[model samples]
Target: MDEMAHKYAHILVAVDGSDGAEVALNKAIESVKHSQGATLDILRVLDLNSLEYGGAGIALDGERIYKIEQANEDYMLKLKERLLKDNEIEHDALRVHLRFGNPKIVILDFQKEYQNDLIIVGSTGKNFIERLVVGSVASYIIRNANCDVLMARTAVNKSK
Candidate 1:
């Protein structure tokens, strides 16, 4: 690899269990494979704001929150297991983080705290109006993150 080519030493990939996120995770794995001594962090943020609005004005009770958290944990664990089985990377080289807060803020904060060299995120392929209403975490990270951001597009989208 050319010295001029950017080599990420610490990669942070945000995953939400979406197809796009799966693509981003694969991309991160590949990047880490090429970069010596690189570590990969997979993060899943349970957006509190989304949950609040998701209930249509009803606040989530404690039991509901616990259930959601548990489900998120299970999902992350499954993802980790799949990655380990399918990739050559060691178990210790990969870390999974499940956090609560706004997705954008949590991701940016994590990158800053870890001083990650690169951030990988998946594009939801939301239309203009939907993006305007729900907000695009990838777009926000690209505009604000201090490190390099990779917005992994779905394979279907790439053909277009």
Candidate 2:
């Protein structure tokens, strides 16, 4: 492989506050480290459609929903800070994008808008098990994304 050709100029890493997702983010950061011109775009998608109104005899309030959204944003912000604080990578080139929608759609839309060179995501174990189930976002993105996708497995890729 040509070291220069494999350089990722623009990368998008999707995280959902999962340990597996953090591993993927670390992999994306590693790629940016190799390509000095590369830029890292970290995204956290908030799925409002899945928000329950009344479930299991429980009620949710508007204030609670707002708080949830705020918490998600704050989490992403903290992640951005941690990535930037690392001296090995250029902090000025890192960006964080927070969106509310289906994660699959949001990711694909951002890929198209930014023309991202690569998309990195954490692979769920459901793909290997026939009886087990997995969330739809990872499946949808893996099947639909036009650009190259890297599905990081927890054992192989550890968070930095």
Candidate 3:
């Protein structure tokens, strides 16, 4: 790959609150900052189905459910703020989106919707092992997505 050529025009970055996601996001921002032609879209998919059946024994209070939804939204906003404020990634070059569904589908749909030049996703997400046993979201995206993809090793999260 010609890393120096900088051919990508529009980049779609998929973040799943993983530490690896931070790396992917940073990489995308750096690409946009360098390539005047590139614009970055940050996508966070909340797998509502996973949340519902994720085996968290604690029964959800109705307000808690709403809070979880709100938290997801807040996380997206914070991603924008972190990029714009901390990294100085240009506002004009950035956009943030939140989707509720299967991450693999959401990513592909976003790629089609935005016609992204490239997609940057973490190799390991919240459901990495599950992905391994069945299939990884990243793998699914790579197999089905039309655009180029960048898959990092592991996310850098507080848990790790």
Candidate 4:
């Protein structure tokens, strides 16, 4: 007899070009492979507003923002191509989304629009101080997201 398989129709994974996010992406890819007819949605959220600066009013440098978006898009496109080539899956099975907003809020809010049954994220993408100041995205999701959340991690501290 074979054990029952859990088939997830829709899966969402957030990536930020970090080691933790890399692990999460790998897990998401594996999940899409095993679950027949499942679709993997990879999202990378950029906060251009955070780059804005002004003495009194909000100021955004269009040139800088454009450069960042262009670079980010290139990165996402390369990842998408590699995933398609390495996985041997249909092109439509994998979807890439780039949005501008607060990652912590936008990630969970995304489920409302796309209705992802499963959300996978890195254990801690931000550094120690950043996590302290802005808080961990994974922790926020675990507390707020109604759907199932998985924290993918790596043995980066195994040496100690």
lDDT of 4 at 114: 92
Clashing pairs in 4: none
Off by over 4 Å in 2: 1-6, 52-61, 125-135, 156-160
**What does candidate 4 score on TM?**
0.85
Assess each prediction's global lDDT (C-alpha) against the native. 0.86, 0.79, 0.79, 0.84
In what order do the candidates fall by lDDT, top score first?
Answer: 1, 4, 3, 2
Order of models, best TM-score first: 1, 4, 3, 2
For residue 71, give model 4's deviation from the true position in Å.
1.7
* TM, every model: 0.88, 0.80, 0.81, 0.85
Give candidate 4's total backbone clashes.
0
**Pick by TM-score: 2 or 3, better one:** 3
Candidate 4 structure lDDT: 0.84
lDDT of 3 by residue, 31-125 (tens): 78877667899998887556754477756667966887799889888878877887756688899998878988888998999999898876665
List model 1 lDDT by residue over 27-140, tens digit each. 899887767678899999998657663557788888988999999999889889998898888788888999999988999999999889899999875789989997888999
lDDT for 75 in candidate 4 is 89
What are the per-residue Cα lDDT tens digits for candidate 4 across 1-160? 0111264778899998878888889888988887777788999999765654555366667887788899999989999999999996779989998989998899988976899988988888578999889899889998899888888887767563
Top lDDT prediction, candidate number = 1
